[model samples]
Target: MGAEHYPPPWFSVAPMMEWTDNHYRTLARLISKKAWLYSEMLAAETIVYQTGNLDRFLAYGPEQHPIVLQIGGNNLENLAKATQLATPYGYDEINFNCGCPSPRVAGHGCFGVRLMLDPKFVAEAMCVIAANTNVPVSVKCRIGLDDHDSYNELCDFIYKVSSQSPTRHFIIHSRKALLNGISPADNRRIPPLKYEYYYALLRDFPDLQFTINGGINSIDEVNAARLEGAHGVMLGRAAYSNPWQILGLVDSAVYGAPLRSITRRQVLEQYQVYGDSVVRMYGLKPHIRDVMKPLLGLFHAEPRNVVWKRKVDAALLRCTTIKSILEETLGEIPDRVLDAPLTEVPSGSTDTFIKAKSLLPPPYTVSEEELL
Candidate 1:
């Protein structure tokens, strides 16, 4: 199917490592049917070498239909093989990871944001990935890296990749990655987010679709970005940390779908059934503790949340099933909190959006030097 046939990538959850796994995605799907979900970045070598164990790495529930599988690698052959291996899993899209700034990924692995330094290689890699998969192809990348953080340089990267490859969608993280000897955590915080660079891409590459990512938290902010001409907006830590608040409102607030009539208690009960089935079938491959990890944040910022969390911690040690965990801890939280429908909408801050607009760079134009 063409990109026009699919649901617009209006809002999505970011592909966070370790956190945006199958279990969390199952929970996220239960909350918002419209929000696009992303699998954690899997290395191409991991998929190529683990051919016998493909299901363990690439398998996802049928409900994760609109999901995208993100893969990272510097080699062309492995990228092709990985895309081929992942194609059978029915991912809606295959995204190349060009934005990860971790030392292990960008520094030693020589992929991720490091790939941005070589746009020709990225264009070739995208072509290889497109050749292998039946689904739409995309790249998730930082605006620039270190000394290359400029509007023209960012435009050059976008222009070459789009012009040379079949890939049309780009997810801009908005911040330039600092490759200096800093922790990955600091890379997210220390480098200031330059949303102007992302907006400028929209102006320069009118035909290519772009999704703005990084630092977007609430549903209100997601709406603000869409209003500001962003094709899409992605949420990272906020969505994981407060799935109820973030994902709960996505259907109604973001997609303009009907308000979800379900409550947290209903969500927990459904998740309980899923957890039991997986534990019964998989055994300790996904331990009971791992299955329950996503539930820890379901009651985020609610009344008696700490007490409920303490009960959850106590239950995790002895509980064998998700049912047992809920039975022991659910009562610590009141029915009013548990049974209440998600009605309150957070009033998000617009200071960042205002600042970004002020810093908007001039519309990109072909200079005479480039025209020659």
Candidate 2:
């Protein structure tokens, strides 16, 4: 029943290209110290294509421990090269992305999802990485791709990859990656969620350590999957957008690690520091606006702040200070919510103690509709 009794290193964040960059990873670390955080998938060709600064793609901040690097590409030689460069950076795991459906990705004849037709290629690629790297090699794959909708095909591919490199773990994304004109966002929800497809995966491959991803929300849902014999749960948008849920899960739901807790106020404080650091390092330029994005819901309360959010969209723009954004928008965050430790929030007394409980979402800033 308890998460601890379930498995080791069970939950992870799927790599979202722009969304899961260093700034987000820094924020995620402040919440959960142990859950595995994945990088936005790095294109193997992109790494090779850049003439001089491959290090630009490789560098990550120090705070992002227990991290995995997700690489998208089907080219074995180039992937091996990228993995060689990535390994020295202290990546805890190297994951091959086999599920992204962007036509841009498929146009190059790479992207792991398309490798489904030739399970041998996926297996050979995994084998190459496993043989060359000392670190654990893993795969993140959709259940099927193109017109190949058979679960048997999926299992066949999984069996091949596992047969070649049993040391590698598998992360199964239950939806089939679409080839038609459907966008990737729709691909997530449009594929009818048959968690039973994932449950059947556990039934079929009892020898493998399988982690299921896509549309998994809430601790209860994760608990149900673990009961079904999944080795872990991988959360994508829910973990990225609402994030604090993942933090809460790390302590209460997953590790039961004696919580050295950080509060919502502390999170806000950290953001202030982060934004300031960006300004300082990037010379008060576009990076500040990029860094201030987490404050979106906060400023959504006011008309001017809404404009500020959109105007500051570039990675090069910087804000003078977020205090102005806060003051101009929601007046001032209620002292109770501002001061309260979100982890130990008193049942419903958030409403009783906080001054502006109705305006904010759950624990972060206020809803956008109430703009001033």
Q: Write the per-residue lDDT of candidate 2 for residues 1-372, one digit (tens) a residue.
A: 112322366778788887777777777777777777889889877776763665556667766767888887778898787777677777777888788887767556656577777777887888777666677788888888767876666766777778666445788887888778788788887876545556666656667778888877655666656654668888888776666655555656665567565565677677667656554353434355555655554322333544544544532233366544444433344555445453532212222112222222222122243222
* lDDT of candidate model 2 versus the reference: 0.66
In candidate 1, what are the lDDT values of residues 1-372, reduced to their tens digit?
Answer: 434555788999999898998899999999999889999999999999999889878998988768999999999999999999998888999999999999989998999999999989999999999999888999999999999998998887887788789989999998999998888888889898889888878878899999999888789999888887889999999999999999999988888888989999999989999988887354456888878888889888888999988988989898899999999888999899898998958556666776787788988776775444
Error of 1 at 149 (Å): 0.9
Compute the lDDT of residue 41 as modeled in candidate 1: 97
lDDT of 1 at 347: 57
The deviation in Å at residue 38 for candidate 1 is 0.4
Q: Give lDDT per model, in order.
A: 0.89, 0.66
TM-scores of the candidates in the order shown:
0.95, 0.80
lDDT of 1 at 109: 99
**Residue runs of model 1 more than 4 Å from their true location after superposition:** 1-5, 280-283, 344-351, 366-372
Quote the positional error of residue 1 for candidate 2 in Å. 30
- The prediction achieving the highest TM-score against the true structure is 1
Model 2 earns a TM-score of 0.80
